[model samples]
Target chain A: MKDERTVPARTATQVKIADAAIRVIAQRGFDVVSVRSVAQQSGLSAGTVQYHYRTRQDLLLAALERSVARQAERIRTVGRVESYRESMALTLRELLPLDGVRYEDAAVWVSYGAAAATRDWLAGPYWSGMRLFHDGVRETLERARADGRLREGLTPETAAPLVTALVNGLTLDHLNAPARVRVEVEAALDRGLRLILRD
Target chain B: MKDERTVPARTATQVKIADAAIRVIAQRGFDVVSVRSVAQQSGLSAGTVQYHYRTRQDLLLAALERSVARQAERIRTVGRVESYRESMALTLRELLPLDGVRYEDAAVWVSYGAAAATRDWLAGPYWSGMRLFHDGVRETLERARADGRLREGLTPETAAPLVTALVNGLTLDHLNAPARVRVEVEAALDRGLRLILRD
Candidate 1:
């Protein structure tokens, strides 16, 4: 009976732990991060972290959910732009690891995504988020096509995956080799957009 | 001294440990994997793994080097292919998680790559390997351009990054969503080739 009353409180604590876990994981990575680290980061006890997430894997799963949710929120918040180019450019720019926190988040997400590939249980939400992001990009391409802003012979269904891939790949490059040749990434994006956009 | 004769043997043993580490890390992730797991995979004692690599991080780094070396070998082999389309197709195809072993390797590399993003010590070889791959693609594009097979305006430098990004992103999408949409990633490649190829 008392467990019922504690449910809401427990859920709140779980959320806190998840959020803290994300930050800690993002900074130190899943490999080096410990339950104590997450607890310390969140200003909670190790017992509380254990109470919410029985194992390190469980904590990672919760952290992944929180991370994906934040990314989805960011995607949703991208307001309507005047042009297709503007919309894509804005959305993609936001997705890039242009800053410290975003870079850490991207890094952590990539790690989790890799783990998800082998483990079916971990793969579900990460894969779904990827699909949703792909779909959203496709919808944007479709809107551009309907507006006659895109070139002829291009379909959103076909182009969406390609565009998403380009953005993602470029993001990885940007993170991997920013000092040496990141400007090329921007140029590549421009060229890709030129290929699809109406002359 | 007797230590001089043991140097070669020690180096050989370290190589074996490194090779085994890749297999273990690929099966389990960098986080879940331990020195003992690597030692077990290598058929060596845990003491041997520790003797070669002082910590789990060191073993992970060694495994990363082995992964890079294998990928570099794959790239070098592909360089022998004559046709541009054939070479590009081969390279992109290899990047896909088409098989269990390759999938595991990709998963492990991606996880390590993500971790490397935050830690400077882990960044070197990973970034170098990426750059090497990028350079190889750029050289391929350059050859195509010299043969007058590519479009007039597009240079290798301009097209290489975009093509690289597109292929990488497509591979990621395929990995994440194998069931829902049969995204013909090759379509993106075809379109990209067409955009850059002369009529």
Candidate 2:
């Protein structure tokens, strides 16, 4: 039988490279980040990084996949909350840049998003990630409406987009103005929840 | 001394450089753009571009200043509308990425914003642009409340953040998922307008 050592070792190396790429891209953005930088960060050779990922775009795509997977896993693990307001608030607050890791993730995602705008090849996964996020919001709202936890006249079809926008907009605001405008974000979140949740 | 011609020529050259830098940065982002690229795009010598702007960050700052000035000028020129609803719609629409030029500006602003998160030197102008955008939204909401155009329970302080978040979130959604979810954005905009506007 052929040696199985190469397979596990290669997989571990790929994960290390991807993690290092995430940190480097988070700090410098996709456009400025180089393969050599990833290698430096990962403590691997440039040749090794290239061996695992064919191009820089490939590496970024892997990273994007990893991020979306993490988000999906979070949603899955968190599952559903008892109340509509708590569910939406919990999902949004989890996604926001409330801590260092999420903040770095937000920064990296924004950079990827900007690059995706110009590069059509990168749009597919990026767009899919956004759709998944929106769909989750819509699903949560629909469940709440079905359970009679949300107010009348506000279907998931109507409320989902608003909630998605509110969460995303508040996240962007927080990322841009972390110090002075955080309270404003919290207030908006509270008001948004109050507006939709049934008494 | 030199000549009276120097001042006008300098001003004209500065305008050319700023316009070129905006185009380049908007296309490739601030970190990826360079003085030589700006010079080539502007049809100026590298020395001339270098002579006018000391560094890429300086060039980006000047371009950012021009963008903010132009946005402020647009709001000024648009002046006050007959009603608060019209004014808010007008301002919010301007922020959207519906057209090509505005899309480019929005994209570039986002890219610069990512950079500004880490680079302290760019933070001041970045935050100021954000403030200008926020203040415009706030003032419009305040005017609406003053004129009894908005619902009784919503004050400017409360409505401003919500409105801002809604518009920004919709714009981001429109950019990210133009094909699949553009209609959702329009619906959200309408719902948001209805939430604040008087019957």
The prediction achieving the highest DockQ against the true structure is 1
Off-target runs (Cα >4 Å) in candidate 2 are A1-13, A44-47, A149-154, A178-180, A196-199, B1-12, B79-81, B179-187
lDDT of each: 0.69, 0.70
Worst 10 residues of 2 chain A by lDDT: A3-12
Error of 2 at B153 (Å): 4.8
TM-score, candidate 1, chain B alone:
0.78
- Which tens-of-lDDT digit does each residue in B20-133 have in candidate 2? 877786666566568899899999998988787877777888788766665566666665567667666766666665666566566666666667766777777778887778
Please provide, for model 2 over A46-90, each residue's C-alpha lDDT reduced to its tens digit, 9 standing for 90 to 100: 998877776777777777766666556665666556667876676
Reference-based lDDT, residue A178, model 1 = 49
RMSD of 2: 4.3
Restricted to chain B, the TM-score per model reads: 0.78, 0.82
Per-prediction share of native contacts kept? 0.57, 0.51
